[model samples]
Target chain A: MTTAQHLAEQWPGERPEAARRLLLAAVDSFSSRGFHATTTRDIATAAGMSPAALYIHYPSKAALLAEISRHGHATTLALVEQAVAGEGDPRARMRELVEQFTAWHARGHTVGRIVNYELRALPEADFAEVAELRRRIEEAVKQLIEEGVAADLFSVAETRTAARAVTSLGIDVARWYNERSSESPEQLGSRYGDLVLRMLGAQVD
Target chain B: MTTAQHLAEQWPGERPEAARRLLLAAVDSFSSRGFHATTTRDIATAAGMSPAALYIHYPSKAALLAEISRHGHATTLALVEQAVAGEGDPRARMRELVEQFTAWHARGHTVGRIVNYELRALPEADFAEVAELRRRIEEAVKQLIEEGVAADLFSVAETRTAARAVTSLGIDVARWYNERSSESPEQLGSRYGDLVLRMLGAQVD
Candidate 1:
């Protein structure tokens, strides 16, 4: 097997750095050139290896994209889940969710782009898999909104739409967010959290 | 000039139906295969036209892309400008913007996709030209939010970010929106408008 082929082998270990290298390259190429536009060769070259080496690590370009998309969505879901699973009123939990979400996207916008922008490019089965997880995330947000409505924290004719709007605000961070901009990611997150809290009529401070 | 050249010459205007036919083919090919992965032949074949015929209306693939992108943005701006220009309360105007935006994307989804998803393909000069109009629309939203804040009709820190969120939600409508599954575009627009207004804290009947 080629050197590229050798690297394609997944060792049974944490190997965080190697995984990070692979994911980072995948995200850059995926966002810049798109899924179909990018090639395994391009990704491997960018990762400082031959395409064969990439295959040893990744079976195909679709697989690489799926891995990245899966990780990114799972990460966002984890953060969001953690944010809302905490103690305090539903409003407080919602604030935490917003803060975590905005901060994550602000700092790592590319991850969001990879997760959301490339959703359409995923192969049908893979797309369905990712969609299931995305639906989970959406449900989390939906539940949060429903809880807020139940608590009289948020008044809306349709909790589903409210959930979608709030979720869209958060999901969109990946598209227009910039970490190097004037506002720090934390500051931006807090600001957005404030807005979300107010919108929901949650007690601030 | 070849038929491709002819397509370029009459493109985007003279033959309205043909323009849309070619544009739809272009959107699918561009989004799926991307500009480089796709060729004039790919689009021509998709449009069921000779490559030369495709060129007759579009000078080059890049030109074809630019035209589609231009039409999408311009149409959006026109719709918003029209929707908001009428005499209505700021809250009403916000609803109008959301309704018009969602409807436009739902109806002109392919155009929206090509406009948004293909930004990177645009040459630097072309990119800036298209992006400027998008920026202006964004700025207009910011201004609206700021006005709401000033008038105590709405409350949100960082009008700019709220505007970003709002625009982000609307722009991404085409990315995942599907008409076949369920939910009419008007319903989505109306529902989206309702949520946006509530988020903005507009206490309207």
Candidate 2:
């Protein structure tokens, strides 16, 4: 399956049917309209439920957003972790890491955009948890760069800043990605991987 | 003066004080709260005016946002244009381009964040105009990269993609910048210039 299709399927969370509908509605609403602008009624309507039906699933819009944020971050963190799991040359590992990260952002841009851009809208408590997931994502990338440096495959002046830029190249993909755009998620992922490898002064194929 | 301070001073549009106050309020509201979530009432209250008073300045909240976007784009375009002007070496030109672009995003992040991220929020007509300005910005960068390649000073395989990535490195800076952050705008601009130069395979001094 295409990466975008995979992402589409992943959005069908493991909640009950009613709750899933509400969550899906929240995703659509929050992705297009800012979280603050979307009301419980709008979400309920989108999900084909009554206004109060939303209450049974989510207490408030913020709660709904929190659920979405947590789920998105957790899933993404899992993807990043999985991307880095296989053993290889550190350079190859970094390539896989950038490819997968970029693919996720391109394919799952709605949730990715919100997860990366809308942290302020999440309640403070949820923000902390989501931020932790983000930190781990950064650390995963950082560790790869550090490993590459130790292996002498990469010549980077500052591993931390280089890692951030590498990830930023992927994260910012969500900000511009659209299906109508020319590049496929896989193509974008591969291209960005090469560009980041270039930035690190790695031997680029 | 600091770039942020300079950006802060750039918000006073060619409007009357009341209108400028309304625009400033919109910038704060849109920056903190996503544009859709911020109501006319919120803007007016933030500006210390009644809800009805906003109509005297802007016909609608979207109009106010459009105004801010147009002004912001114009100023940034001017900056980008000037950065690429009077350049000696193509390498030096690219370095200056990245530096000034990064500084703009860092200092003008309050509005830059919105302008870069909230294109979907703009009306269709206004979006077209803003998009054209964006195209010009991208074209300018691409032209510079092309010039460097033609001169054999830079070795980028994909000039368009490389230019986009270079700009993205700076644009994404706005999403995470805070006054409390350790790196000042000038410092960040300098660092990013080096990084882009590195990505271009330019010899770093």
Candidate 3:
């Protein structure tokens, strides 16, 4: 699928078509212009709706941002959790996790930018909610690394720091990845997977 | 020094005091609220100047952002170049480079965020200028890695991708580092230095 289609599919499928449209528009505006700079009117206009209609679906611009932030965080967390749950040795799992996680960030970079960089603009409660999801995401990666250490599959001085560094490689992709990038998301993710495995001291093919 | 003081000194020392204060204030406001949301008035109020006073120093909000972006990028480039030019083998230089670069991001995260994450808000010409500096920064890192590979001190399938991943580790520190973080900037940098060495397949001490 195209980048636009990938971003459009990020919102929950259960939401009404209009709500999804507004959410997609908010992602575009929030990622491009940032949450603090984007107005509800801009979102409404981008979605081809009136401001009153936007208000009916989402109470305010902050509300739109809150929903987008929650969905993005929750979706990524689910993907990571699934990667962790998959059947593999720690080395194999780490490779899959990094590859898919990095690819997700590259493919959905617009929403990734909003969810990762725009958290400060979120309301206090919304910020806390997203932070909890982030913590879980970090925990999932840490668990994978710890398992690797226990099984003698990896070596690291600090597992927590190692996991954070691993996630950092993928999360920052959102900041820099674009159409002009040299590699496809899959190719980038695959290369990162190799580097991450080496960082973990796992044998690389 | 305190984080605030560290951020304050990021502006060039040769500029007038008033301009420095305004630039510091702009960094605070722009980093927290983002470039598009922050106004000349907000920056002026933060700097204890009137909007007219701010305009006297900076013609517009975008100009303030441009100056801040240019200064931040140039300072980082100079530091990285200095590390590259210093005495040591490629392995030693890479270790020192990652340690210092990571700490710089952690210490001056506010300005780091503006330079790394807020580039989209810059005007066309200003963005191009900053992009040129970023290209050079990447080249410096790539050159170091190339040297390591030439000396058989490091093994990597792609030098450019490795360089990007190495910088990614440091640049993303700005996104997540805070007072609440367990590691000091120095400690974080040191740990990352180790992880990066392993990632580069260099012998760890």
Candidate 4:
């Protein structure tokens, strides 16, 4: 599927369809124009609504960004959480987590790009919450690496740095992922899973 | 030892002191507010110049971005080139490349973040030039990995993916390197160098 199609399926939070359209429109504007440069009118017009109609869903453009940021963060956090929540060997768990995380960034790259890179655009007050959520996401990955090391499944020296490297592999996917590339998200994720395991000195099968 | 000091030392790129000040201002503004959100006025005012004074150095804000983008890209490419030029071995070359690349991103992170993330804001024609430069950078890493594989020094399965992961580790440093985090750029680069060799399945010494 295309990035736009995949983004519509992944994000949008719990808002109604109409509000979801506005959020998606805001994402498109923010993705292309940068959040500060994107006006409410641009979002509204993109959503096929009157400028005032946006206020019915979000009080301000910042609110719109906050919603998208919060929802995207929550969704990604839950994905990592779920990836590690299952019962399995830590090696299997690490591979699964990398696969899921990498695919999320690739499939939902539009929202992924904005949510990953546009952190500064959120209001400072809103940024605190979003940052806390990201902190949790990073922690989740760190825990996985720590587990792998504890079980003797991985031989990583620095758990924190290895965790950051694993997370970075996925996050950077949004920066340079081209759907037209021959590699599918699943293939990329699998390769990344292998690479992460190798980085930790875990045997890759 | 600060990111600012390192940036000044690393990337002035033959411009006059006055023009260098403007480019630095552009980097700061683009780093925080992003390319589209920042006005030429903001850039000029940040540089302690009148609005029109910016035009004397660069024709347009886009021109300023192109100059900054091109210089930043070329600087990074040159650093990577120099790292691999006089290397002892392919594995050593790879480690040195990652070390320098990671340090460059960490130390010059303000400009690094813009050069790494703000490519989308460049005009299509300008982006093409930047993209070609980036392609060459990636190819350099790819060549190093291929060399390691050919010499039986590394056991990477996919040279291209391994190369991309090595590059990603350094590029993402720009996004999350915090001076307050206790890991200096030198320390981070050292750790990253070790980790990268491990990822390439080379023995980490």
Worst 10 residues of 3 chain A by lDDT: A3-12
Candidates sorted by DockQ, best first? 3, 4, 2, 1
TM-score of 1: 0.87
The candidates' DockQ values read 0.42, 0.70, 0.89, 0.81
Candidate 4 wrong stretches, greater than 4 Å: A11-14, A203-205, B11-13
For model 4, the local distance difference test gives: 0.85
In TM-score terms, which candidate is top? Answer: 3
TM-scores, all candidates, are 0.87, 0.93, 0.97, 0.96
B1-205 in candidate 1: lDDT tens per residue? Answer: 2323322433455666666667768877887766657888898899999999887888778887987787678767777777667567778788888988986676655556668767878878888889988987887787777777787888775777778767887877776665562556788899888666656766545
Question: What class would a CAPRI assessor give candidate 1's docking?
Answer: acceptable
Worst 10 residues of 2 chain B by lDDT: B1-10
> TM-score for the first chain of model 4?
0.94
Candidate 3 local Cα displacement, residue B191, angstroms? 0.4
Compute the lDDT for candidate 3: 0.89
Candidate 2: tens digits of C-alpha lDDT, residues B138-181: 88888888888888888887788788888788889888877776
lDDT tens digits by residue: candidate 3, A48-147: 9999999999999988888988988888899899989998798988899999999999998878888888787788999999999999999999999999
**C-alpha positional error of residue B75 in candidate 4 after TM-score superposition, expressed in Å:** 1.3
Q: Please give the distance, in angstroms, between residue B2's alpha carbon in candidate 1 and its true position after superposition.
A: 32
Per-model RMSD to reference: 6.0, 2.3, 1.5, 1.8
Candidates 2 and 3: which is better by lDDT?
Answer: 3
Ranking by TM-score: 3, 4, 2, 1
Displacement of the residue A112 alpha carbon in candidate 4, Å: 1.1
